[model samples]
Target chain A: MAQGNFILREKEYLALQASLKKLLANSYAKVVFLVDKNGSLIASAGATGDFDTTSLASLTAGNIAATGGLASLIGEKEFSILFHEGERDNMHISVVANRIILVVIFDRRSSVGLVRLRVRRTATELERILRDIDAGAGKEEEGDFEELTEADIESLLK
Target chain B: MSFINYSSREINCKIVYYGPGLCGKTTNLQYIYRRTNPESRGKMISLTTDTERTLFFDFLPLSLGEVRGFKTRFHLYTVPGQVFYDASRRLILRGVDGVVFSADSQLTRMDANVESLENLQVNLREQGYDSDRIPLVMQYNKRDLPHVASVAELHALLNYRNVPEFEAVATTGVGVFETLKAIIKLILIDLKKGGR
Candidate 1:
């Protein structure tokens, strides 16, 4: 099982951003984002400025988790992909590498078929980057937090 | 799980508020949401039933300025405390970095409080976290209510690990930030020691 905590270095972060950008462009989606299963917004591209990406990431994760629970109740591992259709827009949410969630939002400009195809291709690249991240996890430069003090934490609350 | 993104200069941590039903878990987050500055917080999302009980979870995203140049973001969550929502509660604990166990202080809720704490431990273990090792704080909520248990009684019943404990009237926002701050401090200390 993969540990929940991990560090995302600049190298993999840029790679993830590039992959999301390409998926957004190819799928003709309004926005594409990558979120950790824990609901942290890792990276995003496209028309994210118009929406609250934080809430979007969180709700997406929650939706996936709830669906996953249902899947297990029926003796399935998980429902890797979920779709929600709205009158004006649609959301395509899928689990990548069983850890990260890939979300694409689109409207009349795209179809589910196109989004599915684009996500399939991008999911591979995303998984590769995630593996790279896992391989290099915990190897970051140390001592960054060694000097941290309780006073420093107190200052933030102030 | 705590995600440290060096590229974005941000550290994101998930802290969950857990307790039995009507123990003021949601009230704690609501209080923080209302008191927080608009610029430092994101929209608060509550997935509740028609009757307003939490059916899934309540999420609040907060930015606690910065620590050592990296922006610190804490995503707060409250699990549905009703017993039947055990599965939903387990999902919310998937990647939790810390937990604030909100214990209702009413004398009659002692059994409920004990049961909820045990549930929290079992769920945390299933998610690969050791109950004792995880960063946890105890909030004795609804302190102002009539016929409440004394702090000593509540502590003796709920806090076997002897973690930091606070008395809170969550409806009035009293001790809300104190509980939150204590958990955050423990999480940061854990991170410095290499996160679990």
Candidate 2:
């Protein structure tokens, strides 16, 4: 039917929500949330009900993509931080395991200083968690080139 | 004569629309097709299953105006989002210059979004394209639905790193162009920076 269809299992959602809640509690930011690389809403806490997380997710992914490209221009291997600040609200974006993006949205209710402080530690932990998932997925081993049957190729070509 | 003809004025880049199954990935392409001028777009091709779901891929070629005397053409593709179709997704992602991730907006689709996003990363890594370094854009589709999660909630769960994210309703073409423009602009700028 529809393309890019994603169905979130309850267990994963609970875990994501719990992790987000925990992350938010550690910071004074009035709003703390998360969105997928495709701009889908996963789990969030604080000021989340007010905005379109899906739209924000799309924008966040775009931001990371641009920054990552910028990183390469500088001869860097990867891009990490996409942090920005405004007069009233500040945003910080980081890449975690190259899979999911970790975003922190804070306002004057929480200083940019505090968001940055929490982001540093949270990003590391998020990376580790994603790494664990990767290890468990059994696709971690390199060079997984499956020989394609002619039928398979034909099917794709069609 | 060069076999590949890379020195030609026209530069072609591949952009893939990737995500989990039924996440409105195809809808994004369809909306783009409907809105684009017939002269500016090629015939839309879809390889689908017996049930008519896109079993393999969807392809659309678009001309994104001209730059520096060379026409910039983008071949947009969407991989089958089903979990079992990982191989196909990988194959499609190869040689891609940019990506637009079309995430489903429903609350229940959260895990699938995360899993598919991870899949994109793994596949990209396997192909020697670092996901973190590629020009990627995110689109949370189906924003017109009522059961969708709030943007704050989504940001907390999916956007811990705060990437360029967008809100879209693919069926109606809302925010689709914005998403495409953002990724294309990013890719073009990257090429310019690389002196390509």
Candidate 3:
């Protein structure tokens, strides 16, 4: 067990990977990434080298969290989706299962309408998989994690 | 929450530096970002105001080698410490694996320190994390200041559970890594216990 553990077992991982891949195929987005509400990168598929995916995941969670705050201020239950459009890139972020967030980054090649349409279909499937994953993970998320050698942890320091 | 990427062989943990406004929470992250090798650290991002006050948070992504085959990545963040930013503070604590309360050592700021500590507990509770059980550390910062609270006094007010505490002059880097290591060590121990 590491800190902030969000365990996705093999079954869940495959399902998430497949869902992401499917989303990318059906949509015109450059990347389809999934992030936990805590800003942890769950699964990110498609090309994502324009920016660090890890950083993107963290900031996305923060963005969603901040937006949730704004929603509270406005007396809304929650803002389930966020859209940020840039000159060169556009992003669509949707809250999935109230626990995870799905982000679709697109370029001029795609329209928000198409992305939203595909996302609407994929989101329901993603949510179903997520519920199953949570139920399956239980408390044994890292039950098989072996104790690490000293050299292993020390290597990161260097 | 810790995100495990078996495919990438990585484990990501979030640790938040929390305290009253201007309590050197951001300073600690800047020191760490400065000291860490660029290869092992991501770009430090600060969401700040025109006055450079941390408007949202200061994030520094650090990769501290690996455990077993998994790279241990720690995302260190500092909440907007001003009291008025309570909403943002609670948001930052959502998946916190550990906390470092950077209490200002100035006697005049004692009230702010105490308030921030209480706020941390309340915020953590809102996120379903027990402050007592979480891996938490305290750093009495700005110890070099002329008028500062005594370690005993600060401890009495802040370290209610008597967790590992340190004296820090964050500007000069004193006691920064020591406090960080203490909390990281605690987090690793908890992780070994399956994060119970």
The best-first sequence of candidates by lDDT reads 1, 3, 2
Give residue B65's error in model 3 in angstroms: 1.1
Could you say which candidate leads in lDDT? 1
Candidate 1 chain A TM-score vs. reference chain A: 0.96
Task: Give the better candidate number (1 or 2) by TM-score.
Answer: 1
Q: B60-129 in candidate 2: lDDT tens per residue?
A: 7776655544455677878899999776676666557788888888999999889988888889888777
lDDT (tens digit, per residue) of candidate 1 on B9-69: 8999999999999999999999999999999999999999999999999999999999998
DockQ, 0 to 1 scale, candidate 2: 0.01
lDDT of all predictions, in order shown?
A: 0.93, 0.67, 0.86
DockQ of each candidate's interface versus the true one?
A: 0.66, 0.01, 0.46
DockQ ranking, high to low: 1, 3, 2
Indicate the DockQ of the complex predicted as candidate 3: 0.46
Clashing residue pairs, candidate 1? B1-B95
TM-score of chain B of each: 0.99, 0.93, 0.98
Best by TM-score: 1
- Cα lDDT of candidate 3 equals 0.86
- Give the Å shift of residue B164 in candidate 1: 0.6
lDDT of 3 by residue, B17-61 (tens): 999999999999999999888998998889999999999999998
Give candidate 1 regions above 4 Å deviation: A1-4
